[model samples]
Target: MQKPVIRPRRLRQSVAMRNQVRELNVHPNELVLPVFVREGISEAQEISSLPGIYQHTLDSIRGVVNEAAKAGVGGIMLFGVPAERDAVGSGATDPDGILNRALRVVAEEAGDAITVQADLCLDEFTDHGHCGVLDSRGRVDNDATLERYTEMAVVQAESGAQIIGMSGMMDGQIAAARDALDDAGHDDAVLLAYSAKYASAFYGPFREAVDSQLQGDRRTYQMDPANRREGILEARLDIEEGADIVMVKPAMSYLDVLADVSAESQVPVWAYQVSGEYAMIQAAALNGWIDRERAIAESIVSIRRAGADAVLTYFATEYAQALRAF
Candidate 1:
C-alpha cells in the first residue's frame, strides 16, 4: 500500500489520547436528574413507557434525591402527579399539594448537597392536562394561565425550590414568574425558562411519566419544530424577562435549537433529554442494538457539545456515576 501523506487516526490511537483531544466533556455537575412525585401512592410506580423511570411516592422521592446528591448530580427537576385534577389546576398553587410537598421534602433532605428545582407548569395538576387554564371557548387561556403560573411560582418558592422551571409556553410566563417571586421575597430564587420548547411527538413517554391528562396538542403555543428562528426569539424574550437560565427541550432532536439559543443567550442555556429520548435509547440497548453505557455517555456529551450548560435527563445519576468512574 502507498504511504498516506497525513494520518488523522493518530489522535484516535488510545483512550487517553482521545480523552486528551476531546474538546467537550460532561461533568457530574452538568447532569440534572428529572424526577416525578405522585400523590396518594405509598410505593413508587414504574413508568412503563420510560422503562426504569418511576412515579415516586413522597418517601421514594426523598430517597431518590438523596441518591442523586450522593452521586454528585447537579440537580433534580421535580414534577408532581396530583391525586385530583381541576379545571384551573388548583393543586399547583396549593402549598400542601404533592409537588410543593415533594419540593419541601427534597430540599430538607438534600438541599445542601444538590440544587432542587421545581417544574412550574400546571399540566400534571390540570384536568385538561394542558399547561395552562382553558377559556370558556375551550381554548387555552393565555392570560389566565399566566395568573396561575404567577401563583404557582410563589408557592414553589415558599416550598424551598431553589429554581423554578417555567415549562408552560404562556406568552408572559417568565416575566410573571419573576415578578411573583420577587414580590414574595424570593429574590434569590432562579428561574429556568423552557424557552424553545417544541410541540414534538418525542414527548410521548413524558406524558406517561407525569400521568399527563392532555386532551389536545400544545401546537398553538409551543414552537414548531421546523422553525429555527422562532426558538431564538423565544429565548430572547425569556432572557429579557429575567430568566436566569433558558432551556431547549428534547435535546437530541433540538440540538440545533439548543446551540442557537446557547449562542444568543447571555444567561446559561440548559437542555432536557426528555423521556422519549431516554426510552428510545433504552429500548434499542435492551434489544442489543447498541452499547447502553456508551450510548448514555454519548447522548449527554453530545448535548454538552451542542451548548447545554446543564442537561436534565433520566440518566443523570447513572451518567454522573459513570463520569466518576472514568
Candidate 2:
C-alpha cells in the first residue's frame, strides 16, 4: 500500500494532541441544571424513570441549587409541581404558588453564583394538563394563554427569577412576557423562548417526572418533528418577538434543527437534553450496554458541537463536576 500524503490519523495519535486541536469544548459554565420542586413534600424524592433525578421539597431544593452552584454550572432551571390545579392554572400566576416560591428559594440559594430560571408554562399547574387554558370548545386558547403568561412573567420576576423560560409555545408569548416584565418595572428579567420545541415521543419520561395530567398530545402547539426548516422560522419569530435566547428541545434527536437555529439566530441558542434522552442512557448503562459516564459526556458534547451555546440537562451538575475534576 502506498503511503498517504494526508494522514489524519497523526492528529488522533495522542489524547493530548486531540484535546489541543479540539474544535468544540463543553464547559461547566455552559450547563444549566433543570430541577423539579414539588409542593407538600417533606424530603427529596427520586424520579423512578429518570435515575439520579428527583422531585424535591422547597427545603431540599436549596441543597441541590447550592450544589449546582458549587459545581460551577451556569444556571438552574426550576419546574414546580404544585399541590393544587385549577382551570386557569392559577397556581402558575399566584405570587405564593409553588413555582414562584421555589423561584425565590432558588434565587436565594444561587445568589450571584448562578442564574435562576423558571419555567413559565402552565402544564404542571393546570388540571387539564395543557400548556394553556382551554376555551369553551376544549382547545388551547392562545390569546388567553398569553395573558396568563404575562401574569406569570411579572410574578416570576418578583420571585427573583433572572430568566423566564417561555416553554408553552403559545403565539406571541415572548412579546407578551417582555411587555409584562417592562410594564411591571422588571426590565432586567431575561426571556428564554422554547422556540423550536417539537411534539416528540421522547417527552414520555417528562410526563412522568411532572406527574402530567395530559390526556392527549400537544401537536396543536409544539412543532412537528418532520419539519426542519420550520424550526429556523420559529426561532427567527421568537428573536423578532424579543426573546433574549432561543432553544431547541430534545437536543440529541434534533441536532439538525439546533444547528439551523444556531446559524440563523442573532441571539444565543440553547438545547434541552430532555428526560427521555437521559433515561435511555441510564437504562443502557444499567444494562451494561454502554459506558455510562462516557455516553453522558459524549451526548452533551455533541449538542455543543451542533451549535448550542448552552445546554439544559439533568446531567448538568454531574457533567460539570466531571469537567472540573478533569
Measured on C-alpha atoms, candidate 1 has an lDDT of: 0.92
Q: Note the clash tally of each candidate.
A: 0, 0
* TM-score per candidate: 0.98, 0.99
- What is candidate 1's lDDT per residue for 151-246, written digit by digit as tens? 999999999999999998999899998998899899999999999999999999989888788887999998888999999999999999999999
Candidate 1: residue 129 lDDT (0-100):
89
In TM-score terms, which candidate is top?
A: 2
- What C-alpha lDDT do the candidate models reach, one value each? 0.92, 0.94
Candidate 1 lowest-lDDT run of ten: 207-216
lDDT of 2 at 123: 98
